[model samples]
Target: MFKSLWLQTAYSRDPYPALDQDVTCDICIIGGGLAGIANAYYLAKEGKDVILVEKDTILAGATGNSTGKLTAQHDFVYAKLLKQFGLDQAKLYYGVNEQAIEFARSFAKEGEIKAADSILYSQTKHGTELLRHEMRAYETLGIPGELGKNSELPIHIDATLTMPNESQIHPVRFGQHLAQLAVEAGARIYEHSDVVLMDLKKRLLAMKSGHEIQFTELILCTHYPIEALRGLQVMKLAVDRSYIVAAEGNMPLQGQYISVDSPKRSIRTAQFDDKTFFLLSGESHTAGAESNTEVHYKRLNTDVQELYHLDTLTNRWSAQDPQTPDLIPYAGIISSSMPYVYLSTGNRKWGLSNSLANARIISDLIVGRDNNASQLYAPDRTGFGSFLLQALKISGLVVTEFTGGHLTRTNAPICTHMGCRTRWNEGDETWDCPCHGSRFRKDGSVLEGPATKPLNLK
Candidate 1:
């Protein structure tokens, strides 16, 4: 299961009982993260008999490990989107993100910051200029923001872009709250129920426990949508893993700060046990690309010390998010192969806002209602240029890794997704796929996946 600062800070509860008998429901939601919980809330509120199943416990994956920032300011992403997709697309993306924050605020904890401004500061001249361009995009989209020099920071900032009315929440607390709220609304939740196979025609979900769930509808809100079937999600997604270190320090900063330069350093403060913490997160790379992922954590610690003068490092954790070729999250029908199945994934480190929006879009689709957000987030939408670029990059890596493994590997663990050789993640003690971000424990048990099965240990 997943554990992080949020989970450590929040108390753990007994696992929900595994589904021991057959369950027939109006809707069966898979995955226990933000999207599943949110979907459960919406469906349960509509008075549907919703049965949500989790492979692990609730808040035991990305949601438990996240640095929650409910913001549309996705690291100057609007600037690029504005230039590439035009004003209308950018505005819609921004509006949907804001709408998510509004949804969270309605149920978020008292300490959570609702509509707090998010700031992105640049240390270099080139990055500063990029921030300026981003500020212009913000204005064009009618997004409230300001451009200035933030001198109050422990570090120097040449230029900064402030995104007005963003928000933050304690991720675990919020997730737990949602799960409880959903249950109170008559939703049934089951933990330790890993789905091994899905038969679309039969409308049956076969579990690892040998129990079956029959549902009229299914939603794969799992962080990495479980591909018991060959959905070919590997081609559509790229995984980016980033490190996070949470520590209590003497220095405290104001608004949320994200860097506009490489080796991203996103800074935000959180309060736990009456002490505020400086959560420094950055150093992202494709999962398993680095031979020694631990170095990234050490680098972040040193950077935090040098920049914030923080000497105490309490917690160290990592989380992975996926990117689609077009840079837009996929939220709609899972695939034509399984038209009855729907999913919401590829949060790309912005699950806080995107998951809620995706949940809304999926909930509406299940009810067969016209969702205004459907067009932009269609799972089948293709950007040929982006698709080709991603395909070429991924193909190169897969070919090289497999080709090299053939010469030296005698039974080294191989990725189950497409048979690419797995690389050891030194820090996490898991094998990770460079091709598609599938992860396995040293014993070959699946940790995360597009590959639903464990690696053959022979």
Candidate 2:
């Protein structure tokens, strides 16, 4: 069942090797997930020599564990974006995501990626209202969309929003395809090579294996930047954790969906060798905040069974995406403080769309071109109320971790990538888990699950 759901599933192939000895390139991207691979593809296509380094396999990070929903409807995000940043800013955000949908369709047609069925829905009254607001926002921006009242499923929903051309794909397969194409286009990809430090002054990347590569420019595409340079990405962004369950179904689910309420739930389906599999995801909380993720899994399993009459969970996984307080991604020059460095992050759960959009933005910035999307996604764009709220949330977590009983003394104190205190992960160890709920060892070996890899100490 695991093999059918994950092992033999569409996105499992590996990519070519990295340079065995020190090498140089026009740009060195630090992660091989969606953002890095996509960036490499575009940059290489532009005739720039690119090198991508992955600590593990391509898509092995959050991209591999994604639910694979490729839509711009990021759950009542437009309304918030419009309110927090002005309408002009919100429209820019919407336009970028819309381009992402088109990019996915084009990629699928080119056989770089395959399209899966997708359905949009408003699972709550609030969500239904948000749908109306979103439609008005889209109309004002001159975008096209259709309102869906009834879904193909037997279950009832408050309202549905269908983007007919939107799609889903095996992210791993898509990532690997891009990796190969990038290499064929003259970009190099390396795996199992972890970058430890960046010598900005020397314009070189130092690897944990004691190798250094010099580059004219650098892209910090790692899930989070490993080396703490000038930009405060840790303070500017927060990590959110979401779960997914892949289960065998007697029948196929009509399309992909997402819920608007807290602890959101999303639904979608894929067919493999004549058997239908449903992918259900949601229950987002700040990463390591939940005490028991298994409970969340059980609840999702129960919901699927109750709603779809399906039994037997096949595969389960979780992903962590960076959430910016402003509800937009960060893509462009890293900061005015650093000239040669660039970054792309704060994707929230919309990495499928934002990753590609970011590629275009990053490419523009690297080549000294003007890009409105790049300005919209700039890391320094600020002055939103959401920033204050995010600060409060992070502060609360810090206070709770220090004084709350959830934290148990352990041999190796756990450390969150965002610097929150980790509680004793009794069930797993590798430091107890909470915050985003990822468990790590005293030396950082992932024990429980969900986390695709151990903490990136280097």
| Model number with the top TM-score | 1
Model 2: weakest 10-residue lDDT segment is 424-433
Q: Candidate 2, which segments miss by more than 4 Å at Cα? A: 1-15, 109-120, 399-407, 416-421, 424-443, 446-458
**Candidate 1, lDDT over the whole model:** 0.81
> How many residue pairs collide in each prediction?
0, 16
TM-score for each prediction? Answer: 0.94, 0.88
lDDT of 2 by residue, 163-262 (tens): 5556677676666776777878888888878676678888898876778899999997865666545766655667877777787877765567776555
lDDT of each: 0.81, 0.70
Best by lDDT: 1
Candidate 1, residue 443: CA error in Å?
3.6
lDDT string for model 1 (1-458, tens) is 12577888765566689899988998999988889999999999988899999876887777878887878888879888887678998888888888988889888777654345789999999999998888888889999889998545778788888876678888887888888899999999999888988887899999999889999988888766666344556566778899899878765555788998886899888875678888889989987677699898889889888878888888888888888766678788877776668878888899988999998988888888887777788776655574687756765776777788656664668788778788888878888877778888889988776677899878
